[model samples]
Target: MAYYKTNKDGDGCCSHSDGKEHSNEHIYEVHGHDKNEHYGESCGGSGTCRCEDTHKEDGVRHNGANASSKCGCGTGHGRSACGCGCEENFGSLKQTAFQFGTAAVFFILGILFAFIFYDIKLFNFLNLKLSSVFFLASWTAAGYKVLFTSFKNILRGKIFDENFLMSIATIGAFCLGEWSEGAAVMLFYNLGELVQNSAVEKSRKSIIGLMDLRPEFARIYNPEDLNGEKLINPESVKIGTLICIKPGEKIPLDGIITEGSADLDTSSMTGESLPRAVKPGDEVLAGFVNLTGVIIVKTERDVQNTAAAKMLRLIENAQNRKAKVERFITAFAKVYTPIVTAAAVLISVIPPILNSLIFSAPLNGFESFSPWISRGLVFLVISCPCAFVISVPLGYFGGIGGAAKKGILIKGADYVDALSKAGAVVLDKTGTLTNGVLSVQKIIPSKGASDTGMITAEQKEVLTYVLVAEAHSGHPIANAIRKYASENLSGTEYEEFKKADIQNYSEIAGKGISGLYKGKPLFAGTESFVSDNLNGGISRSENSLSGTRVYAAFDGKYLGCIVLSDTVKTDSEDAVKELQALGVKRIEMLTGDNEVSAKEIAEKLKIRYSANLLPHEKVERFETISSEIKAENKNNTVIFAGDGINDAPVLARADAGIAMGGVGSDAAIEAADVVLMNDNPVLIAEAVKLSRFTRKIVWENIGLAFFIKIGFLGLGAFGIADMWGAVFADVGVALLAVFNSLRAAKCRKA
Candidate 1:
């Protein structure tokens, strides 16, 4: 497809489609010197001319309202649009209206509550003639809606729902002559449900927002007998077909740069805030924004199997997984509800039956015992588990959304709970802690070699010729070498080389690349890559100092070496020190590189322990560390910080895995229990602190509930507290517990 040079909206020029009413004079314009024009006409007989005065030709255009269906879009002069117009937006007017409806429900319930607790019994005094029947009827209407909804789900073979629990509890209240209390409980619960419901909707919105990263379609050029060119979808755009991407548009597929260069905003993929410059021959990822310049990229893969979509699919799957705590909660609730219901029944009936044998019991007081029996029913009503059932999941929902605001995403509540006990940490050196981009530190022309002396002409020919030959390969090291020449050495004549004619060329996937240039075996790679390719008659420095090592070899001999280094993340060293201070006994560095490079990185980060290991080797190392921690100290824990991709298995294996979620792999983000979204490693400390805070809050809520229940029940058993106070012990404590538990929902990372 033919890409447009610029958008008309941006240029403010009247197109042929705009009609003659807006002429070139009336329309505002800004232009530059047209290089293709004649010097006399364009520059006005001089070296400069006003670009705004350049006139344009206008003609009739095809009659179509939208620019998409006709003109350059449908006619193959551009890309096909995949526009939703509504981006990952969670805030909208409809959402505001929903909140208002929730407020109305709470306001009405609040007023009804005031009437119940008042001395005049304002609304109740009017119901004086209606008696308890009117109270029962009011509750029946409200309570039965929940009852029917649960019944419908049950008939459809669904059970253990929170709705079922509330239905049963409200029915028990009506049977106990606590009709007013039952209605009020349902009213308040509905208010809490409204809040919980809103949170769940927001979480769903968070996930949906991520899906917008995937492109729906791409416009392709189709040559046919009837039409010279036509627009097509990315699915039909085959490999090697040139795809065009315009400014402010997402690239439809992954490909190597065949033509053009621009600053690409790839924050959508790598989460780096800066725009990365991409020129011809550089690899461009799918879903990156072309900020400027028109780039024509050849499709390297089909749209369906693009890495961007795969990453989104991984995130979706992670949300379905459950943590150990979540699984236990599910099983515990299943049995706890049934056992308590049976106990409540025995409490109401058994004591009354046993009292029949006592002769000393007052005959006049026998009637009063009925109200006490009814008090037991009110306890059962409040214990419907509605708050516990709904609020627990709601807390986790809020936690994930809060974390996303800070760019951290934990898959589930199980991860949030598991992060509290991070004991050990593991790291991958390059790309994790260090900026993956590297620059050359030194260009050793070789020992005892200088301009016009020290080395023979044969050696000079080999050095200059080999460097240019290797640079032809278009690898990362080659680019760094090219950049070095562009900066320091510019006067030397450069030989144009091609890959197809190069003899004996070979590529190693995980290591590096090498080939023949002018029949001499030329090579460039890490110390290991160069060492393996040469017999090493000339010894090279095998030990890497400061950072990573790169080398060059020719004709089974070590020629020269280049040292490249990546800058460490700003907070990496301090975060490591903080974790060690927190009593983390073991800190390991795992990588796909050799021992020397890994050790160098570990020393810089001040990590006490280290492991230079492979992808699978890291997993084995984590297993040993976790077991050793448990053996030495019962409370010892193991934590791992890694890229979410290759280290995914190890991430899922550890006691706690904290992914550099913003800078690392998607696989690690999905696998780890905790995520450091801001690329600040100090978040590891913050997460541990927050996890401990949440656990403390949970225990506080539970303890407070138990203390109030035991004290108030003891008072009622001895006739010190009235039935009204007993009800407060149940309802009042519950509201307090729910509110207190929300403190755990706070995400410090956000």
Candidate 2:
């Protein structure tokens, strides 16, 4: 006896009398079971076998008094069992090829018979000719699927599709004694459909191949049992678990390295070809390949929350968000088809009736109405809306896929349209245009006014107090101050400052932060913020500093200031120039720094500036700029790029938001429509150029399809074109438009 069950490893296997688990490759030999019994239900039906067998047979069959079976073991099976020798069941592609070949042979024979034996009679019923017999056979073989589908659609209240149009047109051709043209129409249409399907499949494969970064399994690290590391599904791993990644293996989850270091290839995540060297303390995201050394990473997030998973989800959902042009084409097809079908019906009846009355001819026989009905059939064939319906959304899908290859994740086709029309670009001062890393440039002590060579005693006190107050803050400026203190202060002094008790901590947005230390008020913020609360205000200097200055005050006495500077990114100036060269009319910068510092950076890039603005003020400024640009041209849009949490509101309020995914906060990324995987400001310009290219290709397809279709529609209506010409107008135009839309997938770099 043989029985099946799921093993501990979740594999479906069967146990025989030998007490050994046999895989599904071995056939089960059943004894004394009735041939008509439904054994598939006990074995989980056809094709649902968890053993991953190829057989999909549902029931047992007896061959020479012996019954053989293949089962799903416990799952819901789908198809027939393997090695069943079922030659009659062929796939759709094979069936289509066979039918087309047979039709082509019959069609050629019919044309030959018409030329040599035109008067030969094949049958007595209705005086069918020899050529007509072959023609009827060719038509049946070529058009059976179309006729069947048309009938089924009519029953379902769907009478205005390509199948219905083609079926009616070809059948009318046969009734009018145009037998050769009728068969040729169906044959050519099927050929065009085959070419279109091939092109669409190629485009889909090329686009989806760019994102092949999913890791198969993760190795659980076991230091105590180093030789026994088990490989399991990445989704099964929990947070804080230690996972080992060997060289040439993909990092399966977002984590921080705890043991060894390696050179990581982050091209799949960031689209940068250079390999980044990572140390033990460096953070790593999922989908990066380890290049050199083995590293044990402590997973920080579950598999679903990794960056790769989120990116895949974004791409999968992108098709659901349609562009305005795509939506218009879809809606137009729905209204256009029924109207054209109605027009074909009127053309068939009215023209014959009017001729009979005006010329005093009888319209009782098929001969009197044949010419007008043939014209109506031509009209019906030319009226198919396949070209516009298939190619419009396909163009947008190719555009999204092209942008994704460059590591720029656009949320939808609507955003692609918005990016192409960018008129004014508003960039945040830090992280967007300038590197957000800040370093202490200079220190000034109020007590020693002339000490420029070395740090004085009062400067040390100021640095220590600033470090103590800003230790718990997570802002970038606070983190910079802490780093500076750690490197400058001695061990004893750093430890003493870290141990100082503090209470009543408060952080005022965009200005500064304050806390009470040892029952004394301490402040580390802008010069004006510190000077306002002090008993004696500091002296105002006419010479403004080049970088941001954070003033320190304690116990109603001013200590000094620390000037921290952030360098502009190497690609910022080039990116700005490229945007201008691309015909962007306005480029501006928004910052919370002092006007002097903001102006210095803005002048270097030669753009306008708005300084001393809070988060809400930044949004208001963006709105004003957007309105001004739209007033000039309503199609113009404003885009904002930022990386900090405070920039989230402005990022959401702009016409299009671009987030620097490398150093940007979660809130900023969540609010943005486009995300640049790396902190390269040049990517913004690249994205604009790509969007324009994609839009141009889409419009080109639309123009080509409309021009060809409209010209043929007029020709067919006036009897200048035949059914063969109508088939070319409908199917030929669709194939050409589809080929043109494929160019959007191969976007050139700007």
Candidate 3:
């Protein structure tokens, strides 16, 4: 797969659109070995359009054959059935102005004024038809449709669910001679739905905000035609298509660079602040915007089939797969709705029938049937749990929304729940506990060596040759050496760059490489390779511990050594202190670095234990801890956090593998359970606190809802609570639930 910036002659659009129906004349190649062999793919140019054919053959890389662009819709430029070519933008529902509620509020206030002017109270409104107009006005503005649907369903012999509950309760209030109360119920009920809408939109704002990282459309060039005709909607784009990207535009696809150069602000995707300079054959994600200069990209991965895209889609569907304690409410509704309907039926007719019960209790019981029916009406009015039902899920939605605002994308509700259960945390130290930047801190030169501690002319040449070779291999030490030299290199800020052409350039399978250096055959790699392959006798006894060794051999002779060590994060000690302060017991650091370096880091962080480990060694350490926790029945959980190429093994092995600051490694992101978007050491503590906060909110909402319901239900059953009191118990508790859940969103960075 590849992303490219191949421009069709965009200098003039007027001359290109003559309805000429040019065939296989505009599509030109962007990058790769063959241009004529690449097939016609989707047109990615904007306003006007151009088409190229690129095929996904065998559903794998480079296996694809070319094919013509086809829009599902049959219209001209914007003809896709998805209406994708059309000028439509997806916008989330707005919660800024609550319209559904504004209509209901104004309507309620209007009717309340009318009823006051008429001097009609609930008891007197029984015969007062003028006040019915006010009730009607309020009902229509708020819940009138729900009321009608409930009745319509009943005539069809089925209860209408939550709608039925609302209708029955409100009608019962009016029948009991409480017009104002009934109007209030419907008004507030709509307000509750508005809250529901707002809560969902909150999640929408959060979920969609992540997608904001992607561009609205793509610009594509025609491959067949020679004219510079570029098109947009940019649909029909497949992997390996080269599309020109202008400055400040979102990258349309995930691909490698093939032409031009520019600085890329990838912080939105990778969370790194520095603007990365991009040239041809470098991988670009879907969302990152190009910061400076013009860039032409050759797409390497398909637009639809990227890891970033998959992660984005996973977040959208997460809520549907799992939920919080509210799952019980949804399940209960299936049974609760029908049962509540049955209770309403019983309340309405049973009272009038029970007026003659036994003919002994209260004299003239038949004459007193109206009061019995009034009390039954109160029973129906008080039992509606409509408020509780809507707000619970709204809370969870709000929590997730809040998390996304900070760039932390949780993949599922279950992860949220699991986060709340976090009691103990384990972390991989290389990337998570430390900065993962291994540098050359010191150099030990051979006897009678130069001041920079490098030994001979042979040594410096060997060092440069070896450093440059492994620099091609991409180790942390290699990057450090490359960066240090580039910074110290006697040139302007970032010098003119070019790829070096070489002879006898060969790579040792798992080790290093041998190539021509400065017009001489040179070798740079591991000590074993230099010693055995060249069969050269060398002195290595001068170099010492605490760093990774990088050796050099120039003109078939050995040079002295340079050592690399992983640097500790500057605030790691403080981040660890905060964790320890939070009652996080047994904080430890696990690293693949050698024992000396690991011990030094652990000592600096004041950790109780330290493990200098390989991938399997870390796994063994975690297993022992897990068993110890279980044997002692400590009820403690062990979690591992890591962000490294090698930490994948330990990350998956731990209870909860948190991939912290995963900027570069694709494999680490896929392996971990949780990904901390920002590379903050303090976030480990914050995430623990967030999990605890979510749990606290969940329990608080549950306790509030249940306690209020139980208390009011008991009082209402014994006639100690009136219909108004019952309303407070049901709706009041629900409102409290929503307010309580909002706390999860309110958690702070501290």
Candidate 4:
């Protein structure tokens, strides 16, 4: 196995291969190369690139001119290459348009026949019978699917849907001898169905358009011959494999640029409208299109595991999770349908019987009941519960998609509901609210020490000892110390001093490092690490700085301390105010930093603060805060945000766990319910705003649907409305609610 690097011209890129055959391997295979390049000795054919094979388990693709392969994936979506298995025969916009056109012609012809031919008799059929035939023809033309679906659902014992209700009400009109009314009701209902169906399809197209951001092919090249490029399926791309991305191609997977530069269009993933300029060593996510230049990227993840795929999975899975409002609607519809059917029957029978008996009139069997039965048909049509049942979940779906467009990935509908109710938001200090990079703010000299300049000779020696002890460490604090020492010290003296040998270097967890420099012990760490080791060389009284204090000592004598600080993020204060404005009752910062620094930051942000807590103690404090908030107001919920492995516990335990996905640990990301992909603290407030807006839209749909349906029910029962009017009230209201749900997609603030 070997690792090869690519030049700026996108040549000579390769990765490790074990020289064993796998079914689906990366595109880089060992082959004969030029004498100067070092890919391998010869083209042995022992290692094969999986792209040459045409038959994969899911589908087969052929490269030859006459080769044909059957593809049933994404057949009707007009995106056959993406391999999504969406059904093609589910009816298209063209089909809907044709249906509407034909129905309108038939409806107008039936109207002419009913009005003009009522007195003309043909053969044994009366004028009314001829007109009835014309209206029935129009009904069949417009409501064919509704009629067939009703019959099928009846056979399947699923008899409580809108299809069944519509079928029953219109057919009941014919039974009551209102032929024109029956045909008009079915025709108008189908027209509304067409409109609602088209809106829903348009919404699905918006989401599917986002899913199409994945690239179809990856351009791979051999290390020995960069000119020999191969097109391979993105699914076959492996981690750590080098792939070349040309301009106008979508990035196939999550990766880092190995060479070259590009301007990326990230609107599909982050809704950022601007093209971002990226250079080598910068990480790029999937679903962004490369707008300019050809860059070589080394894959960090497989196609299915990239950020784009994860966001899609989250959205698809959000539908399966029921929000509280959705569940309430489901339960309400289930019980309301059967109760209304019984009420329709009672409305037909009881009022007519009581009217004839109480008024002492002659009750004719057929004629006396006909009027009441017509009113019952109107009741049944108004009883259809499709409006509320469909729109509430659709609203949540739109909300989730809108959040992902902003780079906030919410895992489920329950989380959307939780975010709307968020009250107490607890934050981890290091990375959640602060920049998390340690840099020296100031240098402090011991009291009564005369200056050999502000940095005394003793101080320079102590810095040199600290630098030597921290030389091999890769921690941020250590890097800050090393960088300071390199920049401030005289260059010639610093280069010469770097040659001094040190031994027994070791880093103590949560403390610092120690080593032997020139046969004398050197130490640098927290106040406790330096004090206990140095034994009163510099008293603790002189080291009471507000920032992170690192003391240095050599051979049991303390020189001075360096004050390093992790600055609060630029967005932190505004984000806190936004959270408060979004109705978060309390905000708190939790940290392992000392009390003085914690208090200072909390005061500046004007939020509650807890200090000097260990990882487990942080969780305990969060629990106490949560209980107190709940005790005061039971509706309040606690949300925890963090970006470290130690934060996984609290993230999982909180009502809503938000992980900063950009720099978060794998454990924290996996445990979190919501992931802020850009690591912006302000997105928490934005997410809350989006959730609240979605819930508001959902409630509006619910109230509107209920108000319209109930008003129609009363009017139909009192005989003020007929079946035709009921049809309009039912389907028209449903179409309006569906259109209203689309507002969630347009919500820009969240």
Among these predictions, the greatest TM-score belongs to 2
Among residues 3 or more apart in sequence or in different chains, the pairs in candidate 1 whose N, CA or C atoms overlap within 3 Å are: 2-77, 423-637, 424-638, 424-639, 644-667, 644-668
Candidates' TM-scores? 0.67, 0.84, 0.68, 0.78
Instruction: Looking at model 2, report the run of 10 residues with the lowest lDDT sum.
Output: 70-79
lDDT by residue (tens digit), candidate 4, 236-277: 789999998889988888899988899999777665677999
What alpha-carbon RMSD in Å does predicted model 1 have with respect to the real structure?
Answer: 13.5
| Residue range 629-688, candidate 1, lDDT tens digits | 778876666777766476678778877777775333447655776665446677676666
Q: Mind giving the per-residue lDDT tens digits that candidate 3 earns over 1-750?
A: 122322243222212223222222222222222212122223333212232333223211110111332211111232112222111111111221343455466655656566556544454534765556566567666776677778898888777466777777777667666776677767766665555555555455555555455344566654566367564433357766778788988887777777778998876665557888777767778788888887777766664555455555545555554554677767776786666556645654565566446554554543555455444545555556565566655556556656655555555555666555555567677667777777775444444245654344544444455555654656666677666556544444223221344467787543557877667766655556666645556575643466655666666666655667777787677778877777766677776555566777778788845554556777888788767765654556677788876778777776567777653467667776667765677767766666666656666776776677667655654557776676576666666676666666655632
Candidate no. 2 TM-score: 0.84
- Which stretches of model 1 miss by more than 4 angstroms? 1-141, 149-165, 202-319, 358-369, 443-545, 551-553, 577-585, 592-601, 609-624, 634-637, 644-649, 656-750
- Displacement of residue 148 (Cα, Å) in model 3 is 7.4
Give per-residue lDDT, candidate 2, residue 153.
94
lDDT value for candidate 2? 0.76
Between candidates 2 and 3, which one is better according to TM-score? 2
